[model samples]
Target chain A: MKTFLFILAGIISGILGGMGMGGGTLLIPMLTIFFTVPQNIAQSINLVAFIPMSIVVTIINIKGKMIEKKGLLKMIIPAIFTAVLASLAVGRTKNAVLQKSYGVFLIVTGVFFIALTTIKLVKKRKAEKENEK
Target chain B: MSKKKETILYIIIGLVAGFVNGIWGGGGGIFVVPLLVYLMKYEERKAHATAIVIILPLCIVSAITYILQGIYNFPLTIKVGLGVVGGGIVGAFLLKKLSNTVLSYIFYTVMVAAGLRILLM
Candidate 1:
């Protein structure tokens, strides 16, 4: 049963995650709301889980000839500095505040992307109509 | 793909994700993960971890930016990271058994829900 549950979360996370919906959003809430894991554990698990899954995705993209190695090289150094330093800073906040912070971020970003996409779609459709005319 | 273009993308994404992660424990994974995967051609898994790895450095740069003014909640970060990793393992393990149909449906549901959650809020 535990294995079954893990399978459900993993598969769902991987696919949805692959589709670009953001993995942590789903997993964090699932772990906290349903599974009742501590927010800290769940978040840590997310970081750790990302490690292996990232390896898989990297391999697949490489095989598909899709990864832009140049782009990654540019982003790596500055971003790593942020992670380590940020990790050091926030290592002591309360759980509720952390989860809520993540929740709010998820909610806000989800809405922003949806709105942006909708607007983009509308513009595309309008352009299509003009072209047809 | 040019050095200049990639540099702009990295700096922009880094600053944005870093600020958010610095203020909130959420980090760059939420936003950049998808951007890299869908727009930049990163694999899903790589997109996710790369967000972290990328954010690590960006956050440091960002932190340096803020060091003169203030600081972060380090111990809390450790706790949150623990939760993220633990849940991640469990989540990853469960993912293997689900049928594609069920899995996709769940994925869509999450996307819609996340979209709606944002839209409504």
Candidate 2:
């Protein structure tokens, strides 16, 4: 049962991760709430799980020639360094605070993405209407 | 933007996105894709692909840090990792068929649902 649950979690998060939205947003909550894992461990597991998904998706993307080489080159180094530093900081944060802060972050990001996408959709619709006319 | 200016912008996006990934685990792509598409003028598919690539190192470093701190659950992570590998392949293939609009709608719906659930419940 436990293994099954883990597989389920993996599949759910994997799809999101592969899609480039980060699987942890859903995986962390699923772990904490359903599986009763602690916040820190859940987050850690999410990171670990991301490794394989990232690798696979990256490989696929590479094969499909989907990446923007210039953007990848420009961002890779800075991204690594900042990730290392922030990860170290997370290692020291309290679980309760991390959980609350993570929740709030999700809410803000969710609303932001929803609003951005909605506006884009509306703009696209207007453009289509104009074209049709 | 000029080449030099664009490079700087990408760096900025990387720093912010990387920090978020490090702190949280799975949301770096949120910042990455948007910044790449809007700010850097990348195609949607290219942004998504590049974002995944950028996330790889971030996840690796963060996972290592968590391991060093002795916070990881190895068995669970490994199990899920196996599943995600297959899932990732599936999602990657799906990208060819899916439109950017469809993808964005899915992302918005999932993000909002997950956020509201976590925040309210």
The i-RMS of every model, in angstroms, reads 7.0, 1.8
Q: Write the residue-wise lDDT of candidate 2 on A1-133 in tens digits.
A: 8999889888877776666656668888788777878888888888888777777777777888987787676787898888889888888999877877888887788778878878888999999999999
TM-score of the second chain for every model: 0.54, 0.85
Q: Score each candidate by Cα lDDT.
A: 0.55, 0.79
Model 2 alpha-carbon drift over 4 Å, by segment: B98-110, B116-121
Writing each residue's lDDT as its tens digit, candidate 1 over A39-114 gives 6556555544444444554454467564445566556655555555655555566766666666666656656656
Q: Which numbered prediction scores highest in DockQ against the true structure? A: 2
Model 2 chain A: lowest-lDDT 10 consecutive positions: A15-24
**TM-scores of the candidates in the order shown:** 0.62, 0.91
Two-chain DockQ for each candidate model: 0.15, 0.68
Q: Which tens-of-lDDT digit does each residue in B11-102 have in candidate 1?
A: 77765665565544343667786677656777765665466445444434444433333343344334444434445444444445553444
